[model samples]
Target: MTQPAQVPDATHRSVDVPGGRIHLVEQGTGPLVLLVHGFPESWYSWRHQLPVLAAAGFRAVAIDVRGYGRSSKPRDIEAYRMLAHVADNVGVVRALGEETAVVVGHDWGSTIAANTALLRPDVFTAVGLLSVPYAPRNGFRPTDAFAMMGGPEEFYVSYFQRPGRAEAEIERDVRGWLAGFYGVLSGDAVPPADGGDPHFVPPGGKLSDRFPDASLPSWLGEADLDVYAHEFERTGLTGALNRYRNMDRDWEDLAAWDGAPITQPSLFIGGALDASTTWLADAIKAYPTTLPGLVSSHILDGCGHWVQQERADEVNRLLTDWLRSLPGRARP
Candidate 1:
């Protein structure tokens, strides 16, 4: 790991990329580790991991993806295409004056990091994916996959595909929507089985309608919640929603890697209690086949979808350990 020229304690700054200006929170002074945040989140999502990575001899640059936070939010739905997202990230690395670095992502960002590695391994040498596993492109539109899932009107992604509808509901009450979504998705929130009405989220109603009283989890504090709410209030979910609108476009864009596998060294960290775990269990099982260079796989018992935040220490340990394990990762 090579050190950065000047690694400050912590700083928020802007970097001009090809797509637009990106707001970032950076720390540390060693090998570059770019952290991409997911939906309904900003660069703040990686606050906990930033210092940890910095301490472990890494230059951690956590950026708000194009749509969210202080980054540019192009109104055109087409602007949020997958290829554009990948390009922004690649440009961020170049803008930072680095050739290559480790790439890490969570939730939707997981897809970003994985695809970035798949698409440009020369730039992202090693990869770390949290929450979501790497799903290979199957030459079908993402909407097609969701349509095949064939759920009720409440099938979340299907509902999101309707455009203006989701944004209307979510943006109507940004803070409430944030609290509701975070509340229901956390590890502590149990999904109702036996197909009950008024599901954790119904197909017709708003996200805030399901849970009247929204509270913060241990990992997510009131101050943290406030930060998220403030940013969402400023951005108004348009850019984030636009990403969903580009689902089919992303599927169309990634046709080049139909059967291609992510050949770089990779590590996956997921939560066992997370509903995503059940489906991804098989993916992890088949990881050797899908991610041929997978170094290890771990599912923390009782952890949930918000694995990195819910269990910051564990996640940081897993991430730094994996980076150290990479060939030539040693630094003085």
Candidate 2:
């Protein structure tokens, strides 16, 4: 695995959003591209992609969202909700003197990117999503993994809603948590041939019982691990954890739009090995089936949850290709 180019030349800027100031790092110069990071990560997650995008003749800006990194860390759980996240993106784009940008988001950031495109389609020319799909609101019902995956294949998302338990477990052992989270998707452990085992789930669930010695992929060196560890250690897990807590609220807020569709040209990129795809399989199928505007979907082979970082070459290729295909003010 080639190491990412260590370009520590990000120009920091802050924008006043509704809740607080959002910190962002802008580098390179060309057409605008907003790179958003996800849970348990900061803008550092896009270290590889930033310079590549910049070199491709695009002005790339990676943000620390609202609560992560040097950004404003709000104590209130409500402040980290979906609408607030969407507004932050809009505010950043406007503050940076751009009308529309190609929004690229991964993991939890994917959720917000989709919401931003839907809530303010005018702000984004296109969207590139990694890992998670656009979750549509369906009547504001409380749905769990058990309801979606039957009796045995439960405990994945349920682990997130366990009320201070997941955070406690992860915070107590950050390295262990990072290992478990990345290990499952890195193909270190053979998945059950017949779907997933009743006991197998990502990170803080039952899988830890079976694979006590599991470690993160060799691709993730100690430096990478330390970056994630330091951020989560400083910020604690509340900000990231609050994302799960607001699912119901998000569902309710989105419930008003019964059949809303994502009109923006959108792309779905996921690791062929990641289990998140399995969890949201139904929604993915239902999306294009219901809303025909979803342009393309790509499942990258030999990758996991951290698709962009783990498979930077393939990801950069796809992103550049997609950006080139789009009709924009500037072109390479």
User: Against the true structure, whose TM-score is highest?
Assistant: 1
The C-alpha stretches of model 2 lying farther than 4 A from their native spots are 1-6, 143-154, 188-212, 287-291, 329-332
What TM-score would every model get versus the actual structure? 0.92, 0.87
For 186-249, candidate 1 gives per-residue lDDT tens digits of 7776343334422234545554555435456667888778788888877688788787788788
Local distance difference test scores for all models: 0.81, 0.74
Segments in model 1 whose C-alpha atoms lie over 4 Å from true places = 1-8, 190-203, 212-214
In candidate 2, the residue pairs with backbone N, CA or C atoms under 3 Å apart (3 or more residues apart, or in different chains) clash, namely: none
Best prediction by lDDT: 1
Question: lDDT of candidate 1 vs native?
Answer: 0.81
